[model samples]
Target chain A: MRRVAIVQGEYHVVYQPGVVISTLLGSCVAACLQDPVARVGGMNHFLLGEPGADVPVNPADMQRYGVHAMELLINDLMKRGAQRSRLRGHLYGGANIVAGLGGIGTKNGQFARNFMRTEGIALDHCDLGGTQARKVEFMPYEGRVRATLVQDQPLPPVERPRPAPVAQPTGELELF
Target chain B: MPAASAIKVMVVDDQTSMRAMIRRALQDLGFKDIRDKAGPVEALAAIKADRVHLIISDYNMPDMDGLQFLEAVRQDPVIGKTVFIMLTGSADKEIVQKAAALGVNNYVVKPFAPAALKEKIERVFGELV
Candidate 1:
């Protein structure tokens, strides 16, 4: 049994022997994809909602971002002799902890789901949306994903304000 | 250089939680003096006066945007090259180009994982600390 810490800015691709790799997340997303039939899989914790966050020390930036992470996860598993046709995804996180941000969480979740769809990848499970954050664990060999929701208050139902009734103009209606 | 002291970082984001999170992330990485500001109105003056080794600022803000703040800082030779890292929500190519023109040292988009920020900050502060 090996326990590892995935620190900020650092990531790991563990070849666990039937063991699960886990990590904590909030707005940051973690994607777990596996080839169930082949029994090999991998996951990546992407920091931002999109690409371009990857900073290259020099002029050549690092090839790491949500989009890039997703692509890498698939490619790495494939390189390990996994079949792309038998692959499935499990995405987690994209919570909205900040106030008045009804769009951030939804947008991130949508982006992940859409990316999976656009790439012709099958997403078997997803534990996303809501104001709550999550901690996720994945077993690549078992093709299982576990997500635990964190301390987050339920978002109060939006209360739409009614517009004041417009008063009828008292001008003469002779023109009619 | 023999570990030129720990990096003293300052986080300036509009969201208090975000500022706190970034500060915590940096602190977890053993970075000291992780000062924070909710907006740039007060932060701009503080940047000019304070001896902050590095700055992680938000691009979109209610007051004084990140570009303006960076420009203002550049005007003064003191804090001009203060290892500026822009933490924003936008990843548009145009914005990235503009940020590069503004002399931004690094750009870490929002909704970033702790690991992601840690890597970038550590890389940027590798020399200072």
Candidate 2:
């Protein structure tokens, strides 16, 4: 079986048999859309929503956003002969691994939910929003989806150097 | 004087939002010399041009993954010894082992709070006082 690794901000669709698509996700979200009747499925990995004032200025960078990734994935699925009405969604990732970094995961998950709702696609399964990263695998031809929680193994402690002392101002004042 | 304010910290992530979030957190933590790059390639270029006291990099990127970038830094004589903290979504033991072998100073999982990031930095470089 041929395996295609989906990197961050990318998506792939498969219609042929014996092909597997997989991705590693952290705060990013991956939406697996499958047309069960047509046996056509695709997956997308996206980092955030549409670009706004704070987004990167490069137009190519916008492809990583949720809106663009989702559109690309959906369009590919339909282009591959999958019917929109038969499409089912499986959402993964959106884990809040960095608890204090704000809620990119939550936001991505919400975007996925809203995207499905707005597109009229049914969500068949979901594993989203937690502290652990996820590894997702999908067999598009079989409509088999598997999501595993990547282990949160603790790193061994290491010795660190003491902080260097800061230079202090001299008490004597000199006029220039 | 606050310790973190003098440190030159660079944040590298493919996602603009992640970079902005980390930059905001660093600013809130009183870090003054904070620079952000979109990915490892740009970050490497920046490091070659000037030195950064500490680096906070996302693990996954299109050009060079964090581990590969870390290894590259370790090999570089000029900026090899700079403190590096990896920001990853995966806590998998294998990745942790690889990072440790590559001499990463610390690892912070994704979606981390500003306080948590500060704590990790303090753990490596002492408190921000």
What's the lDDT for all of these models? Answer: 0.63, 0.77
Q: Which lDDT tens digits does candidate 2 get at residues A101-125? A: 6887898898888778766789999
- iRMS values in order, in angstroms? 19.9, 17.6
Model 1, A129-174: lDDT tens digits are 7777677777777776788886854433322212222323222111
Which pairs of residues clash in candidate 2, taking residues 3 or more apart in a chain or in different chains? A97-B110, A98-B110, A98-B111, A98-B112, A99-B111, A99-B112, A100-B112, A100-B113, A101-B112, A101-B113
Error of model 2, residue A37, in angstroms:
1.7
Candidate 1 scores an iRMS of: 19.9
> Model 1: residues >4 Å from true position, as ranges?
A7-15, A51-64, A100-102, A152-176, B1-129
* All candidates: CA RMSD (Å): 21.4, 15.8
lDDT of predicted model 2: 0.77
